[model samples]
Target chain A: MGSIHLPSHEARLACRQNRLTNTAGVAPGYLQANLLILPAQHAADFHDLCLRNPVSCPLVGKTTTPGDAHAVQPAGCIQFPDFDIRTDFPQYRIYQNGEYLESRRDLLDVWTSGHVAFLIGCSFSFEDALTTAGLQPRHQQTGTIVAMYRSNIPLLPAGIFTGGHCIVSMRPYRPEQIDRVREVTRTYLSTHGEPVAWGWEGAKQLGITEINNPDFGEPQVFEEGEVPVFWACGVTPQMAVEAAGDRIKGLVFAHEPGHMLVTDWTSNDLDKLRPGII
Target chain B: MGSIHLPSHEARLACRQNRLTNTAGVAPGYLQANLLILPAQHAADFHDLCLRNPVSCPLVGKTTTPGDAHAVQPAGCIQFPDFDIRTDFPQYRIYQNGEYLESRRDLLDVWTSGHVAFLIGCSFSFEDALTTAGLQPRHQQTGTIVAMYRSNIPLLPAGIFTGGHCIVSMRPYRPEQIDRVREVTRTYLSTHGEPVAWGWEGAKQLGITEINNPDFGEPQVFEEGEVPVFWACGVTPQMAVEAAGDRIKGLVFAHEPGHMLVTDWTSNDLDKLRPGII
Candidate 1:
């Protein structure tokens, strides 16, 4: 009631108390991570899933035991964002064993101990770096969502995680300018790095017709002269979660399409956190 | 006569014909570049001075129009390379306005058309790339003849061009990792991209120890953790032509560092390229 525009932690506390849902554009600079709250029994398998499919789920942080919200890595500035996991996210998919259950925004009633939580890295950070480098994000340029395509390229899976295809994000560029892109994205390999796929010949294998069915978002018309480059998307994990037959229950993910957790980490700082830096 | 393996081109023609002297290794991947054989008439007022300044004194294919050997891009690739000034590379430098400068392995007696030639772009094509990627020439890594030093990084002022601190290549790293060494070499901006400054930190305002100093090549130990990086030794250019105190000579610039003659070409053949694949 005071001033909805500039809400403080106190307001966030109140919101939690009232069970206000939806996290899009919340805590801008601080990370708003994808949460995978699973029973302690499935934690190890989930952890392995994260390790294998790092691009889609670079393991930022996770809890050691079930029901522990305070993971090693925090997506946001706040420690163990206190609130009911069941109902905090704008939506949640309850899967029994792996079968579709029901979607609910609040998991408070279903909240119980012995559930592990995980937070992963996303493309937002690198995208931020690109903007600073003067490479304008094409999606932002068009004021449209980056078209995401389900790729035929399969994701390497961990236990119970199977049949997950890579979700790709494409950006168009002329051949000569690719050197600049490579120069900018070179250091980012640990996060997302350079494009995983390029050229039109390989597009067909990914089920991208460049003409056929429109996928997730509007396709930018690639000029005859430019190459359509694609990067591995972070949505692969969720796709995998949907695939595995009835093992994961009470799955949690960011409901907003492009909304992602923004961490305090910077690419330069990440350079320090890497093995060589240490 | 010496137990050696000179490049086939040099062995078959220049070297065997006694028309070439000095190290042929430097010109291996590059076409044999030459200078002009010009009389003193046209070598006056800035134009003549331009030829001697290392930056612009490119390997002139011919002096006086048709007296020298012309080198190709990838060196030896072009069968009928177009060149006329006079003579081939091994050595070619003549001064009509100045003193009796007779330095030519072939025709030291004749000065055709009295036209002076300029020699430039001494680097072999993409060999820098190969080196950065760590492609070690089987013979060169040992106690070899690559020389390096700290020249006062200098500039051209009208008649004269000052030399900078540079290396003449006497360093060596493990053969196995040379590919990576080559990879980084391609990125060096000298002659092409912004060449890696010879020394680590610039000697800004003096009174500081230059990093890559104490002569050429990394810290002799270069241990397991180190990587050997390189640049187009700036001295090579500065030394190509002598600094004639009074500006009265000829001018030229061999080729851009990478010879990036942008063709009206588009390559969907990503398979043909190495680094950009993924």
Candidate 2:
């Protein structure tokens, strides 16, 4: 609290103790990721889906064993120290074989050694890149969850992770800024790179309806030449997790998108650093 | 012939007569691609090879007909105008079942109705991004081809293409520039983004040698703060074609080292663009 730039770990810790319960943004510079914890059995298919749907799920970090938390990286990357593999996130969405069960605050009710969690890359990382480049996200400026839409485009499926349409967040920009912003965000996002689609028709194809009214974030005015630029959201994976359901059983992720594990690993590491480091 | 930017017709006229026999750098704004012309019988395996070895052999365009020299594209953005596909290239390398039979100035001698030509991406498209960002390539400064080495890393093999150590082109960059260079190229290079290896032991791992020496191009200096960054060279497809030796009949690519087909598609169009335009 006294000397920190990003407070992801602090907030997660607070939430673990029931003192903090809010949507992310509490952490500033540190990367925020979507969590997808599951058992070892579905690991390969989930891994394949992330690989196939790289634009939507450009993997940040993962584990081989179901509960081997230390298997994440070359050690010393988790910011909050040795974490409990079973009960780290603030909330949990439990499903029974692809059916919605209920969203619970604690998994202590059914914790086990057979589960593994994944920390996925989020657009939050690019929010910093955008702010630094003076292309601050319009949704964040208005304090809203950026609009996400189910698109007509189909995702390349993996195993049973089927039929999840791409979910995207939009940011309006002048046509000129589109290419430059493309250069900026891509340079920072590393794994996923820049906007996969631009132009109004691409938005329309993705099921976006408004130029000014957004489905997720605070509605903002498109002054002058601003046009909507959309990127596939990390929520696609959650949809996959939900679709996989509980027959696969014991799936886990950060609770309600509020709790996230801040890691010592740089999400940009594999993207920016030489692969030899591994 | 005297104009600054030669139109498609003029460019072909000059190319047919051997007048425009150097690098096609002026036709530089859009996509430039390598050409691989083979018989229809071998197209399936070759296409499969391109699909498997996408990084080094990004298939930009291809002909569905054995001798058709046209390609269909997305909603008309840019296109290679109708020009002679046979004589458009400055040089052509003739391969008879993987053997380097001869190098010719044009394809006039072997133009056949049963040939299918493929257009592949050139690394130069990424160079535009480099210069646009004010990053100067050391090889360009020294005025030479970037030094290329055969690395010990085995390529992902496909039918007719056997796995062997990959051929790599090396560019020495200071540690800081690695991230920038990697990110910039990664945005447009498809699966070919980022450096694969960068240490002294890197060459040996790929079964390549003469650390300070090279098999092709002039030596690149690894300045005090720089480390050599290795990328899977586009010449990789050549390796596959060579390995496919005698398994099929004829094969050839356009003449001149960097000379390639300029497509009507964007390098960003990871799928649609065909082999050679015209």
Candidate 3:
């Protein structure tokens, strides 16, 4: 638990040694990324999917080339140094032909040159921004993981990756604070960005009928006059992989829910790295 | 030449009918893109290259899926409607096993389901911004094409795409107007944003020796107290294709240098569509 206060590199070192189980609060201001590793053959389609659905899956880093795991390529710059995709995450979930296999502390036994690692932006990166704006997330206040749900919003399908829904993470905010929340979170582009929907009506519009029952993470208690604000979740790519099923010919690996890769970049770095205007 | 003032769809229609030869000033305020078409096998690596080198290749649109030409996928939204990759561009240059083949008005004779089309951001998109700021490009004032050069800066390699240099386009501006020039152009993210290098020293840093002569497009004269400004060019991917030589398995097609794909989207639409903080 004390490792949460460490810098990104030290936290990653802690993760490598199995000293940490979850990275929810680790390295407070650094960028935390969702992990997804796939076979080289399926890499292109998944890349195209990320390009098409950036809000759901904003790419932060990836292996320089297929099978090379040491350096990561973030937007605009060539190298994110001192990182190993295989051992940097606290834990990894293994899936084969769309079915869950098991969890591992590291991918030492399974990773190969045929694999390509991708790092997607995580909602955790924007949590600090919310707190800084004095709008603490209800789940964080209750000391639990943020609530995530599968929405009725269908993603634009790419290649054999089809029939996937946009998974969203929710946080409770008062009606008055919603605008400020949007103003704060929207700047964290590499993260999930602005809320996709807000209020109870927003939830209904997304077809999320089970408000209190989340597919992942613990449910939060809504205060009086509070509305549920939803954002595109990083879990989307995992669901996309599952929907593709046996069409995916090889093994898939992702960060265990609540456990992520703490990156060398920060939110400010991402803002600067965004394309076009700075 | 009258088609330059037409709407994007009508301009594309004019291009398809061979009524247009260049797209430099077509459909003012709309986005114009550089075209790169590759066989399905080499598309992935080239996509990876674009990701690694965004300044030289800011992707604005691409085919929905491999072999699909009717729709284009920009950043956030799923589709840019009514686009035909094969015929929308005024002209295309054909290459075989990396060697220069021929130029064609349309790819109808060589079209196959095995090809993928990518639309990269062109410097022409920023010319409108420059003009609006009262910093008209010297090339445009002289009624000539922007001067393009092969710089010594190398691109980050991706798979089979290697040994490629960053190609650049040059425009001259008065020394006093340089700061305003950057402030205006930097906001056009979908277009090549901001000058990568400026002044004679900047050109020297890029390893361009002959300032008066360029590899492509006509040369422009620098006035007294004016300096050369360089931005990452859309021709980079083409030069990369030439560098890779026969490693590319099948046919490759790119817009004839100055002829581009006029898109339905505008600069304002791109600003709103940019990921994060919009």
The most accurate candidate by TM-score is: 3
Q: Estimate each model's TM-score.
A: 0.41, 0.49, 0.54
Cα lDDT of model 3 by residue, B141-162, tens digit:
7777778999865554555676
> Could you tell me the lDDT of residue B129 within candidate 3?
75
* Whole-model lDDT values for every prediction: 0.42, 0.58, 0.78
Better of 1 and 2 by DockQ: 2
List runs of model 3 lying over 4 Å from the truth.
Answer: A1-278, B1-6, B272-278
- Model 1 agreement with the true structure over B1-278: per-residue lDDT tens digits: 13443343333345334453543244434333323333344333223223222222322222223333343221112222332223333444344433335544444355443434433333233343454445643223442323344443222222222222222332334545544443343331112211222222322311124434435323333445433333334224423234432333543222212111111111111112111111
Candidate 3 local lDDT, A1-278, one digit each (tens): 24343488888889888898767767888888898999999986787567545667777777768778886777657347777889988899999988789999999889988999888889888788788889878877777877899986555455557567788999999999987887777666567677777889878877898888999888889988898998888888998899999999889999887788887778769755452221
Q: On a 0 to 100 scale, what is the lDDT of residue A165 in model 2?
A: 59
Judged by lDDT relative to the true structure, which candidate is superior, 2 or 3? 3
Once model 3 is optimally superposed onto the true structure by TM-score, how far is the C-alpha of residue A204 displaced, in angstroms?
Answer: 60
Docking quality of model 1: it rates as: incorrect
Interface CA RMSD of each prediction in angstroms? 21.4, 15.9, 16.6
Candidate 2 scores an iRMS of 15.9
Q: How much lDDT does candidate 1 score?
A: 0.42
Report the lDDT tens digits of candidate 2 across residue range A1-278. 33553355565566567564434454556555566667777776676566445556655666656667545542123333445544555566665565556777767766557776666666666676678778887766766556666554445445556555566667778888887776665543323446656668657655677656644434555668778877666666666766556536554543454344444334444343211111
lDDT, candidate 2, at A245:
62
The Cα error of candidate 3 at residue A164, in Å, is 43
